[model samples]
Target: MEEGICYLTLNRPQRLNAMDPSLLEGLLEGLQGAAAEGARVVAIEGVGRAFSAGADLVEFYRA
Candidate 1:
């Protein structure tokens, strides 16, 4: 927490931080946790070149 802000970093730089089910779940949980912890602001960042490549189509197509 920095200056009442919470930062959530997407860790999968190898895949350009693709949004798989696990990642989505973790994001949701992280947001909830941040809110519960009384964070005034939330910041989402990604590692590597892209912030996100959006949803993982491989996982989507598999469903």
Candidate 2:
């Protein structure tokens, strides 16, 4: 958390960090962490060209 606020980031770049089942768990964790710590606010960001592609084509192909 930053400034007593929660900051969560998507770590997938190759696929624009698309949200899969795993992402939900991590996001839930972040919110839970912030809530547990009594955070004043929550923020989300991306570390790639786009916020998210919504889904991962690479993984789909791979699977």
Candidate 3:
């Protein structure tokens, strides 16, 4: 990884690290950081079996 590279790992393993608003914000922050740092790469990883389930429907269902 580049020194300027940014990464955000979704720590939700049982739930497949589904994307939430917080995760979105984190991603945005990472993107901004990478851009600000003039990074050539930004990577996102999940601790679970999937990179992401796209979004968490259960969380959305509450809203």
Model 1 gets an lDDT of 0.94
lDDT of 3 by residue, 1-63 (tens): 468677767787887888777777877887787788887777778896888888888887886
Deviation in Å, model 1, residue 45 alpha carbon: 0.5
Residues 1-63, candidate 2: write the lDDT tens digits: 768888889887777879776776788998998999999998888888978778665566775
The residue ranges of model 3 lying beyond 4 angstroms of the native Cα positions read: 1-4
Report the C-alpha displacement of residue 27, candidate 3, in angstroms. 1.3
Q: Which regions in candidate 1 have their CA more than 4 angstroms from the true location? A: none
lDDT of each: 0.94, 0.81, 0.78
lDDT, ranked from best to worst: 1, 2, 3
Per-residue lDDT tens digits of candidate 1, residues 6-61? 99999988889999999999999999999998999999999999999999899888
Q: What TM-score fits each model?
A: 0.91, 0.77, 0.76
TM-score of 1: 0.91
